[model samples]
Target: MESEMIVIHAENAPMPGISKPGPHQRYRHPVISVEKRRLGALHADEIRVQMIYAGLCGTDVHLMESDPQTGYIRSSAPANIPETGRVIGHEGIGKVLAVGKNVRHLSEGAVVTFESIIVCHYCDVCRKGQFNQCRNAKLLGLEKDGIFGKVVDVPAMLAHDVTPIIQTDQDLQAIACVEPAGVAYVACRNTRVTGGDVVVIFGGGPIGVFAAMLCKTIFGASSVSIVEPVSFRRSFAAQWADHVYDVEAFFANMPECIDVVIEASGDLQNINRIFRNVNANGRIALLARSGTSLVLDAMDHMITNAISIIGSRGHLCGAFNDIISLYKQGRLPLHQVVTHILDGTDGFMRLVGAIDSVLYENCKVLIRFASANGRS
Candidate 1:
């Protein structure tokens, strides 16, 4: 269990002269309250983290506004309001408060970020070396309460230390982005992107921009273009993508054939359009999430063009280490992806706004839970 200090209100009580609220109270110390975990665990391989920053994902937004009647979120636990009914956020970066005795490489006070998908390594799929396809997978924020609160306990294998690569405050802010970058890396790997190949990504969102960057930096693609209707997002994407075009402009000025197409927007229409745009022997990686299904001409478009359609769901565990190494080497421009930073108080509302899709032009929104001094 974790505890939080709360200042008591009383008449004639002296205020503290501390710089931050936690340990430096000059007068009476704040009261400590026990934090409850929805799912109980302190496994030998688990580590407890005191979350300092958490990034808001599109999926977080989906859960916020999902209709109860339709049941868009399918999970064993209540996604909307888990055990504590507190704020829920998945993409997180924090300090290791405690590590179980069996944990080897990690220690207390280490700055780290973790993978959201908790995979059961002993499962049949995991035994096949396909951990991403684990039959009994539970997502952090989806199946249980997430790291929106001040503390979270997660499996040590999912945690990666960011202290070596994160030098400045900006670098620390970008740690939350590493997870999504890994997602894009997996998408590009699924498409079998190679050097000197032309890539077109649909969606100028964070994942799309990250995919574009990964194509040029990691995959060594010859050129990359992004298709998005939002001018703000297009301009932001232009900083990384070789070319940025709106949906109509993408259709008007598209190349005769695209070597690779990555669908990251989850827009049904954009997904269907990939069939006519991909070149012969090209590959399409679908990384989008949508409620509606898209119909495509499989025989005429896929078979005739020899285009391989693949769906990429989650990132491989090693991808995080790879992306962090690249970032440390100054190869990836991850810091440029975060456009908005919010105080922890407004994280839930801002995440809801980000999910609306049309309401906000967000690349990445981060929630600052506590400062370096431990003040909220």
Candidate 2:
């Protein structure tokens, strides 16, 4: 049955008449329109989903404000806006309404969430169980259609049945956040944050906050400190971090006692300073994505101290299940990360406004679909 659905489409071209901004400033906001479009047919391995809630991610914002001249987004990978534009969202949860004949795991009326990366199982990396690094992976919302609309067709393999763990509306909300939370989980897991470790996170954004929370509540870190320049973010992170410091205050009171460092902020100026703060044999995990070249002057410090630096990319397949398990156990308070929930009926302008206010006013913003209240 063909039906019309509302979708948020990101335009490939820049917004008319807006000049590009200086570095670190917002670029010409990409042209996004909320319009009704006909739904496509479901493939044999796909399932039809009715989106309930979708989280706004940093990648989405980068794609929306892509470089005007190149039309490229600076994120985990460099991607140019497709000529036909694209649907712009990845983190979300929904209810399954129909399953294709080839689908076996999920069923109708099942609540579910999805992994953003669609990997080819035949790839060499996938054969070795490193599906996250699959050579031919396609990122949803960027390389293909995303789940920003009221209804979407998702590959059954990429959808996880989260119905068992969702006991409340809040649980449903937290499940929508599993994607970003998984990124933080992988960072902390790779760094091996354990008991007695004094960890420090360089950014207090959603990822940094999640890392800090895991360090203290899940990973057993003795002390977790967060450094952020935004006062609102610092205040928000104080609940999870043992201490929160503004960039100036953090440098002024620099202590060489950290056992692990997680760089969630893409600010390159702190590269050298991070080496100085860690104790000997400390581990550092880089979680942020940046297009600019990073310059460091603390090579000697890193070598002499035996510090290991690790670069973490996207989350693995297991991360989503692990996060869902944690949430089921009540160990993860993922709901706290959501600061704003805008109704989709407000349209594209409201979403753009919410994105603009993120730097100062919001932590995690969600768009609730108008049909969310009526489930199959």
lDDT of 2 by residue, 1-376 (tens): 5432333333344445648622223223356766555666779899998888888888777655655565544453434345455666788899998999999899999989988888999988999998878899888886777888778888888899998887777887899999989999999988999999999899998899999988999999998999998889999889999999999898888666889889988886776766777898999888787755567788888899899888877777599989889988989999999988877636445767556677677788887873445442
Would you give me the overall lDDT of model 1?
0.72
Residue 284 miss distance in model 2 (angstroms):
1.5
RMSD to the hidden true structure, all candidates = 11.5, 4.2
Superposed Cα deviation of residue 95, candidate 2 (Å) = 0.5
Model 2: residue 376 alpha-carbon error in angstroms: 12
lDDT values, one for every candidate: 0.72, 0.79
TM-scores for candidates 1 onward, in order: 0.83, 0.89
Predicted structure 1, TM vs. truth: 0.83
Model 1, position 59, has a per-residue lDDT of: 64
Q: Which ranges of candidate 1 are over 4 A from the true structure?
A: 1-43, 67-87, 350-359
Error of 2 at 329 (Å): 0.9
